[model samples]
Target: MADVKLDIRPVGAALGAEIRGVDLNHLRDDEFAAIEQAFADHLVVFFPEQDLTPDGHREFAARFGELEVINGLKKLDDQHPEIVVLDDAVTPAADVWHTDVTYRESPPITAILHMVECPPVGGDTMWINLYQAYETLSPPMKEMLEGCTAVHVNRYGAGNHEHPVVRVHPVTGRKSLYVNRIFASHIRQLSRPESRVLLEFLYRWCEQSRFSVRYRWSPGGVGMWDNRCTLHSVVNDWSGSRIIQRITVLGDKPTGLGEPRWPKFEPNANGASDFYDKNYPF
Candidate 1:
């Protein structure tokens, strides 16, 4: 294969980049290496106008790691069991910010999504830099979070898992806030009231506009993000058909700083405390 030069442009101050001058279907080995480097540096990368087939999309994603079928989610088809099709017509769009499948013992390392169809306007996606989220915290807040673990459970009855509130990234050795509103239920080190208050504060802090990048989707545009150090959500502002297909690379169990052992608090029923139900009322 011939050498290819890439034009990488940062889309936000916190965490996103757009790569030009390479096609997903025909990426050279050297180009892929640069792509990998860009992914590590940017946390989330987008490649616009690459019309890739389903098999091509899977092949590109498989290069980063083992592609896993998302638990409690249906696959796009039997031929491509690893792909999850997100069609707005049939599926409920997620507007809440979240890291994918954190309820699992091992959550996804990364996610690659290809927009098969795009609405004429709206339907943009947003990503948060979790590293910045952790870094921006006060010293005391960081110290407190590093010592705590939080519970995450799938809303669809998949499974429950506890991970460090602050997780150190395996590759970069940088720390990130691992909790999200969708799956992360509560912190174990604090009482229910304390946990709820702290978790809510962290949730709001992590989602500030200064730490995010919003991408407007177009047909054949492919976006990928490192799930270990980021949270993402969709803007539910569109009214027409919008479809995306995604493949996720599997990750290992999260390792926390100090691995501090604390008394395990009993998790709320279905990962929802009575307070949450009464107040939130979803």
Candidate 2:
């Protein structure tokens, strides 16, 4: 394929970029490759004024990889199970910092969100560069976290998995701080109280404004993120309705700097008593 030139503009000093002169509904192979490269460099890339239907959205997202169907989440299109919808009526629970589907054995590698409706003001989304979050850690703290693993439980009572506290990005081969406040239950190597204190500290540290970038949404706007190395949060200050459709690309099980370990027995038992099916959430 011939090379395609794209107009890319960085949105902030931290982790976002806005790409111009491309439409998601009609993208060439070279254009898609350029967008993919930009996504890797920026962690989160936004495209404004590209209108896409549910089918169009899924088609564009599928270009990245196989689409991940999120079970137990509301779907916007019955025929297109890949299109997961988030709106005001459900009271968005993702306001806390999180990487999508970390409780699963293999979490999503990328997430594509398209804005369908937006209030007159507010309802912006924020993303943090986890790679930077790890690099900026003090030497002693980094040493302490080197070989630790953490348990991430599905809050909805679906499943649980152990992931390295510092995960190596499969694509970029860079280390990223992998724990989040929403799903990470505790560090396996630390005592309960010690785990709680360290997790809280890491959560607050990762959320520092220096490592994040906030994006304001508009109709027909699209945000695509590399979920393997970032944590995102949606601002819920908007009173009026807001809607966004999302598609997640399937990913491999997270691998870290050293040998991996699994729990001896099922850790998800004794939760809410709901039948736990292997489900992925956005």
Best by lDDT: 1
What TM-score does each of the candidates earn?
0.90, 0.89
Cα lDDT tens digits for candidate 2, 36-154: 88887899999998888787788899888899887878988779999888877884547889998799999988889888888889999999999999999998888768678888998
**TM-score top scorer:** 1
Candidate 1, residue 83: the lDDT equals: 93
Candidate 1, clashing residue pairs? none
Locate the minimum summed-lDDT window of 10 residues in model 1: 273-282
Q: State, as a TM-score between 0 and 1, how close model 1 is to the true structure.
A: 0.90
Give the Cα lDDT of each candidate.
Answer: 0.88, 0.85
lDDT of 1: 0.88
